[model samples]
Target: MRQSRFEQAFLAYLCTMDVLITVVSWLASYFISSLAWSLDFYPQQGETPPFWWCLRTVPAVILVSLLSYRLSGLYQLGRRWPLWQEVFHVLKATGLMLLLLVATTFFARNPYESRLASVIFLALTSVGLVLGRRCWGIYFRLRRRWGLVDSKALIVGTGRLAKNLDVALRSNNWMAMEPMGFIDDGVHSSVGRATQTVGGIEDLPKLVEEHGINCVFVALPLSRYAATKKILRLLRDTLVEVRLIPDVPALTPLAVQIGELEGLPTLNLRSSPYSFLDGLLKRTVDVVFASLGLVVISPLMGLIALIVKLSDGGPIFYGQERMGLDGRKFLMLKFRSMRVNAETESGPVWASQGDQRRTRFGAFLRETSLDELPQLFNVLRGDMSLVGPRPERPYFINNFRESIPKYMLRHSVKAGITGWAQVNGWRGNTSLRKRIQYDLYYITNWSIWFDFRILFMTVRAMWDKHAY
Candidate 1:
C-alpha cells in the first residue's frame, strides 16, 4: 500500500499545530514583553512595536518553524520515536527555528526588534511545541489501542532475523503494526514456535489480498538472494509496501547508507558518520573546549609534572605513537605515569592492577586519570577529539585489527582522551570486544549532545575502579 492515510493525516495535523503554536507564541511573547517593559522589568528606550506590526512576522515565524521541524526529521512518516526523543527533536527544531529567525532578522526591515520578545518567543514556542507533541502522542496511543490506526504487516521469512523483527514490532506497539504471520518456502527449526509459517512464498499475493496486508517485510538472509529476488518480483504486482531487512553481518558496525553513483545503486558499508557541517561543528567545539580546558587546568598539570619529576627524575611528559582517524599515527601526550623504560623489559603491555612499574606519584595520577590531562593539547592540535574511541598504541592496534572484527572501524573518527568505552567502565583491561562495541556505537551516533554527555560521564568516571 501507499503511505498510510493515518500517517498523512498525522503529518498534516502536526504541521497545522506547529503553525498555530508559532503564531500564538509570537503574539503572546509580544504582549508579555510589553507588559514586562511597562512594569520596568525589561528596561527599554521606547515602547514595543504595535500588535499588527509584530503580527506581520507571524507568517515568517510559522514558515521557519515548519521548515526547521521538517529538516529535523519531525515530519518523517511512520517514525515510532519515544516521547522523550520526540520532545528532544522538537526542542532542536525550535532552537534551529529561532536561529534562522535571528539570522534573517539582521537583514529584514522589521520594526519588532525586542530581544526580550524574541527570547520569550523562543521559550514559549519550545514549551508549546513539546507539550503539543506529547499530547498528540498520548492521543495517538489511545487511538492505536482502539485499533483505529493498526497496519497489518506480513513477514517473508521464518528465520531468526524474521523472528527477531516480529519481537521488535510487537514490543513497539506504539507503531501499530501487527504482524500477520510468516511466508517462507520451508519452515526452519529455528523459527519461533509461536509465529508459525502461514504459507509458502507462493501464497504471498493471495494472502496479501485476503488479509488486506498493508506492508511486507523481507527479512531473508543473504544466502537466500535468489528467493529474495523472486519475492521482490512477486511484490511488484501487489499493492503492499515492501521493506527489506538486510541481514548484514555483525562485523560491519557502521550504519548502512544508500547511495547512487551514475545511476547505479550502492550501499556504503564503510563510511564516516560525520557530514562536513558536523565535522566543522565538532572541530570547533574540540578546539574551544580543549583550549579552555588546558588553560584552566595548566597549574594542576604543572604540579603533577613536578611530582612526577621529583619522584623518579623521569620525563615529565610521555608521548607515544598511537593510531587515530584513518589509521594515521599521532603522538598522544600524557603526564608521565610510569618510570622511564618501565615497558622496556616487558615490551608494550596493558597496565595492570598493583603493577610494580608505576611510581608512587604515577600510581596516584593513573588512579585519578590525571595523566590524560596532556591530551587536551592533542585535541587543540587536531590530533584527536574531545570525545571518541580512545587511541591505542600501534603495537596493540596491529594485532587487534588482525584478530578483532571491525576494530579498525573505530578509527573512522578521531581518538579521544575520554570515550564512551572509558566512561562506561570498559577502560584498561576490560573486555576488548565490549570496548569496541561501545566505540563503534559512539562513532555511529556521534552528536554534539552525545559528546557533551560523554565528557560529563568522564568526569564522574574519574575514580572508576577499572582504571589502574
Candidate 2:
C-alpha cells in the first residue's frame, strides 16, 4: 500500500508524544519544589525517577510507537486526505497495547500495583499525540498542494492527449502538479490544441521562460522521432525536468496501475486484479472471515464428517487434489459427495442432476453447502480463501487455459469456496468468458466491502437456480 501524509503525520505525532511525555515528566520532576507538596501523592525529596528510567522508557516508548506505526499504516505515504483512518489505526493499536500492558503490569505485581498513572498516561497521551500530528500533517499537505506553492509541469505534445492531461491538472483539487500548456514541434493541429500551443518546437526556450514550466513531458508520437530528438537537444540549455511519453506503445494497453515501475513506462502490457491497496484489503478480509468461519463452524463440521461416514460405512472425507493459486496443487477436502466407488465408472465428470454417482446424503449436502464446510479447514490450511476464483479441475483448467485470453490470471491468488461468480449467478455450467470476467472483476475491485457483499449475496442465493 502507498504511504500517505496522514500516516507520516501520525508517526511524527507518535514521536512527539514520546518526547513530550519524557521531557514533561523529567522537567516536572526536576523543577517541582518539594516545599509545595504533601505526602498524599508527592514523591519524597530526592525520590525522583532515576535518569536511567527516562533513558530506557522513553526510547522504549518511541520504539513501541514506531512498531504501532507500521501496523496502523501511519508510515504509508500517499496523497489523499487520511481523515479518521489514522485515528482508527492509533486507537486499534493503543487498545491492543493497553490490554497487553495491563496484563503485563498485573503479572508484575500480585494485587496492588501502579495503574492510576497507566490509565491517565494511555488516555491523554495517546489521544493528544495522535490528534496533534493529524492536524499538523493535514495543514502541511494542504500548504504544499492547494496553496500557490506547487510543482510546475509542461506537456511537450499537443492534441487530445495533451488536452486531457491539461484538464486533469486543472481539475485536480490537490495542488500538486500545475500543468503549463503544450510545447509543439510544429505549428500544426498539435500547437492549436495545447492551451494555445506555446509556440512551435523551436519556441521551447520562450515557452519555459514565459509560463515558468519546471517539468517537461515529451508526449510525442513514434513518427516524431526527429522532432523529439531536436526538442531534447533544445532542452539541454534549460534546467527543466524531462519526461518522454512514447505515443504508440504507451497509449496502447494503458491506464494507471499500481506497482507499475515508473522508468519502464513504455512497456506496460499486463493486467493485475486491483492495483495495490485493494488487493491487500481483499486478502485481509479473506483471512479474517475464513478464520472466523473455521473457528465457529468447527463442531458442525465434525458432525458432517460423522454423518458422511455413517451413511455408507465409507470414508467421511474426500481429498481431491486441485490446481490452485499460481498453479500449486492442494488436496481440496469435502464431506464425501459420492459413493465410495462413484468415480470408478466415468471418472471425475461434473455431477449432473439425479446423478447415480452421488449418494442420497451427498445430494443434500451439496445443495445445502454442508459439503463445503471442510473447505473452512482448507482456508485455515492456506490452500484457499473465503472468496475468490473457484479452482477448477486440472482437466478443465488445462482445457480452458488454451481458449481463455488470460485464464491463468485467475490463479494469481488463492481459490475460494464462494466467489463473485457464484454470487452473480455465473456458477454451474456458465460461459467461461463471463465467469472469467467476473473472476477478473473480483481480482480488480476486491475490497472488504465487496467481499462482505459477495458473502451476503452468497448466503441469500444458497438455493439459487444455478446451484445444481
Candidate 3:
C-alpha cells in the first residue's frame, strides 16, 4: 500500500531535517577546526582556507551523507529499531559518508579541504544525526502517547486474523494507529471481550463517518473473498485507506511478498530472505571463521578424538545423514559422542538425559557442546552456516514435516552448528514448535550482525540444561 499523507509528510520532514543537520554539522566542524588551530590545539599546516571554500562543500556533504543514510536504511519508515541499533546505523552511515567525502575531495584535488575538518565533520555529523533522530523519536513517541498524532483504524473482520491484527497494532504503537473497533458481520465472534464489535459490513460507511477512521484493515479469511471485495468497493468512495491482512492458514511464520507478474498480482508465499550479496557476505564470514575455528581448536579436537577412540575403541568421528538447505541430505559430522552402534537398535532416537548409549566422555562432550565442534568442517564445505537453524535427521524430519506447521521452512537456509533454537534452550527434547519459531525468526531476520550476536550467545548457552 502507498504511504498515507501523514507518513509522506513525516518522511519529508525527516529528509529536510537531515539536510539541515548535515549543513549545520559541516559548518560547525569547520568552525571548531579553525578555533582549535587558533588555540594551537590543531597543528597549522598552512594558512587556513577561506570560510567560503569550506562553506562550498556543504552541498556535497549533504548529498553524500543523505545518500549514505538512505543506503544504510536510516529512512525506512515504520522500523521500530532500538536506540543502540539506530545509533549503530548512524555511525555506519556517517563513516561511509566520511569516506565518500574524502575520496571526492581527493579526486577533485580540492586543496581547500582540511584533514582536521574532515575528522571533526565525521564526529559532529555522527553525534548530530544520532541526537537529532533520538529527539525526534522521543517527540513523536510523546505525541503518539498523547493521541495527538494517532490515526484511528477499523478492522473489517471479527475472526482470529482481525483480533491478531488488532493486538499487533496495539502492541506497535509507533505505527500511530489506534484500533477504534471491528466491522464484522457477526459470523465470527472470536474477538476478545475488550475489543468492541461496533458494526457489520453494511454499516462500514456509517461507522467510518462516525468514528472518523483513518484506515480500514480487511482481515477476513481468504474463504470470504466476496465479502472482502464488497468491503473494498464500499470503501472506494471514502478517504479511508484499506489494507488486506491475508489469512493464510499455517503460513503465518513466513513473510508475504506482494508483487505483480506480467501485470497480474502475485503473492509469494515462500521466498528466501537473502539476496545474492547477502549470501556472498554470509558465505565469506562462514568460510573465514570456520577455517580459523578449525585451526584454533585442532589440538583440542585431537585430544578428544584420542579419548573417544581409547574410551570405547569406536570410531573417533560420527557421520549422520541430515537434511540441510532445500531438503538436500548431507552427512553432518560430529565427534562421536555415543557408541559405534548407538542408534542401530533404537533407530534414530533422540538422546535424552542420562541416555545409556552415551559414552562417559561423550556425555561430557555433549554437555560442553564440544561434540558439535566438528560441524565447522560442514560449514566450510558449504553444507551449513556458522549460524542458522540446526539440521535434523531425515527420519525425524519426515514426521515433523507432516505434524508441525512450517517445519520444513527451516531448511530454506543452510543448517548451522549452533542456532537460535539451541541457544534459546529449545534443543533436544524441547518444544519443536518453539524451536521452529526461533529458527523461522532467525531466517526472516538474518544478518551478519545477527549471526555474530547468536554466536556470542552460544558461548554463554554452552552449559544449558537442554544441551543434552
Q: In every candidate, how many clashes are there?
A: 3, 8, 0
Task: Give Cα-based local distance difference scores for all models.
Answer: 0.84, 0.66, 0.85
The predictions' CA RMSDs to the true structure, in order, are: 2.7, 8.2, 2.9
Q: By lDDT, who's the top model here?
A: 3
Tens digits of per-residue lDDT for model 1, 98-212: 8998777667976667889888998898889888877876775677568764688888888778888888776554467778888888663435535667888888989999989
How much does candidate 2 score in TM-score? 0.60
Kindly give the stretch of ten consecutive residues in candidate 2 with the minimal lDDT sum.
Answer: 27-36
lDDT of 1 at 182: 88
TM-score computed on alpha carbons, candidate 3: 0.89
What are the per-residue Cα lDDT tens digits for candidate 3 across 66-104? Answer: 899898888887557777787788888988998888888
Ranking by TM-score: 1, 3, 2
What is the lDDT, from 0 to 100, of the residue 191 in candidate 2?
A: 39
Over 1-468, each residue of candidate 2 has an lDDT whose tens digit, in order, gives 323343345556656664575345433433332222334354443443344443334444445545554665544443333455556555666655555545544564423223343445566645764666666556656765555644677777776566666765555434355665676755544333235565677888777777677777777667665677788788888887776655543432222343437654334444554547766676677677778877888898878888888888999889988988879999998889888878787976777667788788898887777787788778877888888889888977878889887788788777998999888888776777999988877776555556678888988878766544
Mark the regions of model 1 whose C-alpha exceeds 4 Å error after superposition. Answer: 1-7, 38-41, 77-84, 167-175, 188-196, 249-251
TM-score of every candidate: 0.91, 0.60, 0.89
Better of 1 and 3 by TM-score: 1
Which of the numbered candidates is closest to the native, going by highest TM-score?
Answer: 1
Cα-based lDDT at residue 302, candidate 1: 85
